[model samples]
Target: MNGFTGELIGTAILIVFGVGCGANSNLKGAYGKGSSWLYLCLCWGFAVAFGVYAAGQFGADGHLNPAITLGFAAFGFFPWSKVGAYLLGQFIGAFIGALIVIIQYWPHFQIAKGKDDGNVINIFATAPAIRNPLFNFLGELIATFTFTFVLLNLGDFTQGLKPLVVGFLITVVGQGLGGTTGFALNPARDLSPRLAYALLPIPNKTSADWAYAWVPIFGPIVGGILAGGLQYLLH
Candidate 1:
């Protein structure tokens, strides 16, 4: 398969596990409702690893996250010519993955509506725990910076173990820095899912919160660039 196709399928699978877990945990009457943070952290970690493995199998680098693709391109680790394709694939995959989540949890959505809670959107996207845009942006920036930085540098370690290390890195970042903005280190992960939430007809869900959308998108871009530049200097 081509890089674009690999990225698309890999990211879709990643989002299925990542967003599906969130839906299972947050939506009322779901089997995994009330699951703890550790569960989410572990699932997302495995999600990234699985995505990488799947993408690699199809001859792609398996950068299911746009930020990683951008970071590599900026650092000359990836060809600039392919960045657009990778990004497009990632976003498209995320949208499809989120749609599956909505379908899988359709009944729970109705139960959630009865509660009338405004956080139903949390199943699809990230929101600041503190609701401060400026600080929230910074939180995403720092979290993504840490993620991209570690990802870029992991090549120095054991080649066969990089995927597992990346998974643990995601878990650490989510548990350590995710409290602020839910650690949306990938723009495609946040924006595409948010778009799905906005476009889909889910009752009692909160607005898409477009006001905070830029934080995740732009912050990750800036963070990726910073990571690439830093890696360049260190190398």
Candidate 2:
């Protein structure tokens, strides 16, 4: 497996576990419905760890995130030539993963119809608890900055026990800073699945909230770049 294929499969797995957990917690009639925030965080963390492992095993760098790829490239930690392939893989994989979740939760979606259970879009993307766009953007920036900054120190996070450590970092970040905008630290993780939700036919769906989409798309990229810049300065 080359970079594109590895990234594609890895990101698909990431979305499968992460968004599957979202569907389990948010959709009605699911056994794990109304699960706690910590559960969600842990599941997402594990999702990323496993995705990284898969990507590394398949011969990619295990980014699964455009911000990581771009940030590292900007700082010369990664190659610029591969950015397009990695990004394409990440977006496509996220869309596929979201589709899988929709299919897996189809029954729950049917039962959730007209029930006011929750917005189906949340299963595929993030939304702010409060609808302040500026702060929401800032929240994502800070969170991703912290995440990427620490990740820079890891150096080849896909090796040995580093993936688990990365998972632990995600859990802590979610628990600590996720309350604001659900911590969409990766644009592919947020935007692609959101696009899927908007375009796909899922029952009990609400507005895809395209209005707030810029926060996740631009915020994490900026945050990641800043982290890489700072890392460069320090090193």
Candidate 3:
């Protein structure tokens, strides 16, 4: 497959598992409901691994996240000409993946809505455990900085180990820094899914939380740019 198609499918796969796990844990009546945080972390890590594997052969280097694509492009690893296509594919794929999760856990969504414990948007997107925007933005920025930094350097050490390295990187970040903002290291991964949660007709859904949306999107872009600039300077 080409770069666009590869990124599309790869990101779809990532969200299918990533958001799927959240739904499994949060939505009532799901078999895996109440699963531990570690379980979610592992599932997301595996999702990244499998996403990279899915798009490994493509030209875009399996950049299922917009930050990765932009960072690589800014660092001259990826072509700027393809950035739009990659972003399009990633966002679209994430939306579709989230839609699938909604359908898969339709019954659970209704049940959770009835309970009204809180917003079910967490099942589809990231949120702050605490309500501090400064800390939340910093969390995403630092986490994504680490993410893009390690990703940029991985090419020097191994030829084909990026998938596994990135997967583990995600797990480590999730474990160490995800408590604040759920570690939305990718704009597409967060925003598109959030958009889906807003647009989709899930029963008794919560607000889309647009006020905090820019944190994940702009924070990661800022982090990606910084990481890319760092890599460029180092080279």
How many clashes show up per model?
Answer: 0, 0, 0
Q: What is the Å distance of residue 78 in model 1 from its true position?
A: 1.0
Which residue pairs show backbone clashes in model 2? none
The root-mean-square deviation over C-alpha atoms between each candidate and the true structure, in angstroms, is 2.0, 1.1, 1.9
- List candidate 3 segments past 4 Å from native: 114-119, 156-161
Model 3 lDDT per residue over 7-40, tens place: 8988999999999999888776778878898898
Candidate 1 vs candidate 2: the lDDT winner is 2
Rank all candidate structures by their lDDT, best first, as comma-separated numbers. 2, 3, 1
Clashing pairs in 3: none
Every model's TM-score: 0.93, 0.97, 0.94
Question: What is the lDDT for 89 in model 3?
Answer: 89
Best by lDDT: 2
* Tens digits of per-residue lDDT for model 1, 1-235: 3788878888888889999999888877777888998899888998888877777776678888888889889879889998888898899999999999888887777667633432366777888898888888888888888888887866732236677788898899999999888888999999999999999987667678888889889888888888888999999
Deviation in Å, model 3, residue 9 alpha carbon? 0.2
**Candidate 1 RMSD computed on C-alpha atoms after optimal superposition onto the true structure:** 2.0
lDDT of each: 0.83, 0.91, 0.84
